[model samples]
Target: MSTHVPFNALRPGVDAADVRAAIDRVIASGWFVLGPEVEAFEAEFAAASQVPYAVGVGTGTDAITLILRALDIGPGDEVITPPLSAAYSALAVMMAGARPVFADIDPARLTLDPHATEAAITSRTKAILPVHLYGQAADMRAFEGIAARHNLALIEDAAQAQLATFDGRAVGSIGIAGATSFYPTKNLGALGDGGAVITRDAQLAARIKRLRNGGQTSRYHHQEAGANSRLDELQAAILRARLPYLADWTKRRRAIAGRYRSASVPPSLSVPREFDAGHVYHLFPVLTSCREAFQAHCLVQGVETLIHYPVPIPRQPALAATNPAMCPVGDRVCAEIVSLPMYPALSDDQVSTVMGAFSSFVPPTR
Candidate 1:
C-alpha cells in the first residue's frame, strides 16, 4: 500500500487533552468575549512580541484595518504595500478608506524592497505596510529609517511570521503597529479565525481597542465610529494553550528548511533563497519550471501540494475598477511557486518520501 502525505497536515502535534482542558476551563468561566482568556492571551502574545501591548481581534484583516483606522488613515491617505502578497494586505487598506500603493518586492527574499518603497512615496503617502511574507522579516530597520524620514506610520503585516526575526529583532515589535493572524494554518494558529495588533504605543493601542469595539472605551458609550471585531474567549484559550510551544515549533520548521537546503536535488527546481537570519518556514515553497506537471506527479504519487496564491490582487475581479497593473515578477513567481508539506510534527520519513517523488524529474540544462 502506498502512503499518502496530505497538504499541510493541519494542526499536527496538538494534544487533544490540552485543547479539551482549555475548552473546559473556558466553559466554566462563562466570560466569553474579551474576557480573562483574551486578556491572558494578549499579555502572553505581547510578551512574545517584545512589545508593550497586543489586542486580539476577529481576523488578520480586521487587525490591519483597525490599526490603520486608529492611526487616522482615511480616504485621502495612501499606504505603501507590497505588490505580491495576500490580497488582504491591500483589502485592509481599502477597508480603512485608504488607497493602497503597491511596491514591487525583492525577488530573492520575496519581501518589500526598501528602494522601491522609497520611490513609491508621494505627498499623500501616510503609512508603509510591509508584509513579512513566508515567515521572514521585510527589512524592518530599513523601513523604520524610511518611515522616520517621511514621518509615515510603519505598519507590519506579520501574518506568516511568528517568532521569525531580522537581525535578531522581532518583526511585530519593530514597527509602529504590527498585525498578525491566527488562522488555522499559521505557525501560531488558533482553532479558528483570530488575529492581533501589537504596538509599543500605549495611546495607539488604546485607540485601536476603541476602534475594534464600537468606538467605545467604556460599555455602551459610543466615543467614535468603530466596528465589532473581538477575539472570542474559546479561541483565546486555544491560542494561550499553543503559545508556549511557538518558539520550539519555529525551531523545528527552521531545521526542516535547513534539510531542504542541504539536500542534493535537481537544479531545475529552484529552492527558496538563502537568508542570513532565522526563517520559520510556514510553507517550504519551491519553484519549478513545469509546475503543473510537478503537481500532477505529486498527486498521482499520493502527495498533496498547494499554491500560496495563484492570482495577484491586481488581477482579481473585485479590483478591476482599481486598474492594478501586471507585476511581472509577482506573476512569474505565483505561476511557478508551490508549497510542500510543512508542520512541526512532520516526520523525517515523510520529508524523504516527498523529496523522493521530485527526484524522478532530473534538472534540465541552461
Candidate 2:
C-alpha cells in the first residue's frame, strides 16, 4: 500500500504556468513590493467579494489584526468570538490589544452559537468576530441582529472561506469587515503566505489601507504607529492568476464532499455540514472522541490524517498567561477534532481507499 493518499497534496492546478508568467513579468518590471499587482488584486478581490474596497496584506493574521486596529478596538475593548477554531482567532484579538471573549459553538455546525454570543457580551464588548470555520458561513443573520442591538462591529474571520457565501452574499463582504487567508491549504490559496481585508464601508476601508501601509496616506508621512503588513506583489500576481479558476476548483471540492457523504464514513464519525452553496469545504473536519486511535488506524492503512489544532488558544502557554478562562468549548473541540484529506485534486479512488480504512474498524457494541 503506497502512501499516495496522504492527508493533503498541493493541487496548484494546470494554470500555474500563468502564475509563473505573472511573477516573471513582475520581476522583469523592477517595481516590486506594494505596486500594481497589489493594487489590481485589491480591486479584483473587492469586485469578486461584492465589496466597496479590499486591502491586501502580509498574512491572514495581519488581515485580522489590521482590521481590528482600523476599528480602534484595543486595550479595554473585548471581542466576542467562537471557541472552536484555530487559536489564531484569539491571537488576532490579543495582537490588536483586546480581550478575546469566547462563545460556545453550535455542535452540529461547529460555528458560533448566536445565543451564546449575545449572552457573552458586556460593557467592554466592541466587536464580534465570528470565524467561518471549515469554509461554511456562520449564522451571520443572527449575529447581525445582535450586533445592531449592541452597536458592535462585526468582523468576519473568513480565512477558510473564499467563495463561501451567506444568503447569496459573499462571506468577506457580509460583515463590516472580513479577513481571509491565502494559506496554501485554503480554498483559494496563494503560492505562499497572503491575505486580504474586504469591506463595504469606505471609511473603514481607508483606515485598513493605512493600517497595512504604516498609517501613512502620503509618502512617508506617518500619522499613527502602524505595523508593516503589505501583501507582496509577486504573491498578489500569483493569486490573481489563480482567481479565474476558483469557481471550477470549488465545484470539484463540493463534488468530493458529496462523495464522502454518500460513501461509508465511520459510524462514530460526524461529517461536516453542507450549508447552502456557500460551504467551500476547505478542510473536511470530522468529530470523534477517539481521535488518537483513529489517526493511528489511518497511519497503518496508508492514509494520513491531521488535527487542524490540538490545543485551543486559551490553553496555549502564551495565551494562558493573559486570560486563563478564554474559551472552554474551543479547548474541548480542539482535543476531539480531526481533519481528513480535502483538496480538489483528491481522487475518487483516494476517497474509496479512505472509506475502506474506516469500514475496516468497528467499535464493540456496548
Candidate 3:
C-alpha cells in the first residue's frame, strides 16, 4: 500500500511536552504581551541569529515593514526586490510607504539577480530587499558589494529562511537588518503568527522596538506614529521552546531534500540546483513544463503538492499600478515551480513515497 505524504505537518510531535510547558509558564506569569517571554526569546533568537539584537513583532510582514520604516525609508524611496517570492515581500515594501521595483531573478538561483538589481537602481532607490527563497540564502556577498557601491540599504527578507547561512555567515546578520516570520510553518515556528527583526545595529534595533509598539519612547509618551504589532508572550515562549530543535530539524529537511535530489524523475521535471550546501530546504520545489498535470499525477500517487508562488509579484493585479518592469525569468519560474512535501516530520517511508510518485510520472509529449 502506498503511503500518503502531506505537504507539511504543524502538529506538536517531539516538542509537545516542551510546548505545553512553555504555554503553562506564560499563563502562570499572568502577562500576555511584550513581557518577560518576549524579552527572553528576543535575546535567545538574537544569539541564534548571530546578531546583537532582535525585536519581536506581530507578523513577518510587520517585521519587514518595521525594518524599512525604522531605516526612514518611505514615500518616494524605491526598494528593488525579486518578482518571484511570496507577495508579502513586495507588500511589506509598499506597507512602508515606499515603492517596490521588481527585478528579474537568476534562472538557476531563483533569487534576485545582482545584475538586474543593480540595473533597477535609480536616484530614488534606497534599499535592495532580497528574499532567501525556499530556505536558500541569496547571493548576499554580491548584494553586499552592490549595496556598498550604490550606498543602498540591504535588508534581507528572510521569512522563508531561518537558521540559514551564506558563506559561513548567518543570513540575518549579513544585511543591515533581516526580517523573519514564525507563521506556524517556519523552521522555528510558533503556535501562532509571530516574527522578529534581527540586526547588529543597536540604533536600528531600538527604533524597531519603538515602532512595533505604537512608537512609544516611554510609558504613554508617543514619540511618533507607530503601528501596533507586538509579539505576545505565549507565542514567544512557544518559539523559545522550539528554538533548540531547529538545527536538527534543518538537518532532517536537508536530508529529505538530498533524497529528492538523488531520486530519478521524469526527464520533463527539473529539481532546482543547490547554490549552497547551507540550504535548510524550507520547501522542496521542482519545475515542470506541465505543472497542473504533474501535480495531478502526484495527487494520484498519494503525494500532496503546492505552488510556492503561482504568480510573479509584478504581474499581480494589486501591483499593476507599480508599472513594474518585465521580469521574464520570474514569470517563467512562477508557471513552472511546484513544491513537493518537505518537512522535518516526514518519515523516511513517506519520503520514499514522494520520490516514487516522481519516478512513476510520465509527462505528456508536447
Using TM-score, give the best candidate's number: 3
**lDDT (10s digit) by residue, model 1, range 1-366:** 446778875653655678778989999988899898999999999999888999999999999999999988989899998877789998999999888887777878878889888998999999999999888888888899999999999999999987877888878888888999999999998889999999999999999888888998688999999999999999999888888888888888888777767766676687868574667788888888788888887777767899977887777787676656466777778888888888888788777767776666553343
Off by over 4 Å in 3: none
**Model 1 C-alpha lDDT versus the unseen true structure:** 0.85
Clashes of 3: 0
Q: Candidate 2's residue-wise lDDT over 107-171, tens digit each?
A: 77788989889989999999999999988999999989999999999999999999899888899
Each model's total of backbone clashes:
0, 1, 0
Which is the winner by TM-score between candidate 1 and candidate 3?
Answer: 3
User: Candidate 3: lDDT over CA atoms?
Assistant: 0.94
Predict model 2's lDDT versus the native. 0.84
Report every candidate's CA lDDT. Answer: 0.85, 0.84, 0.94
The lDDT-based order of candidates, best leading, equals 3, 1, 2
Alpha-carbon deviation at 28 in model 2, angstroms: 0.6
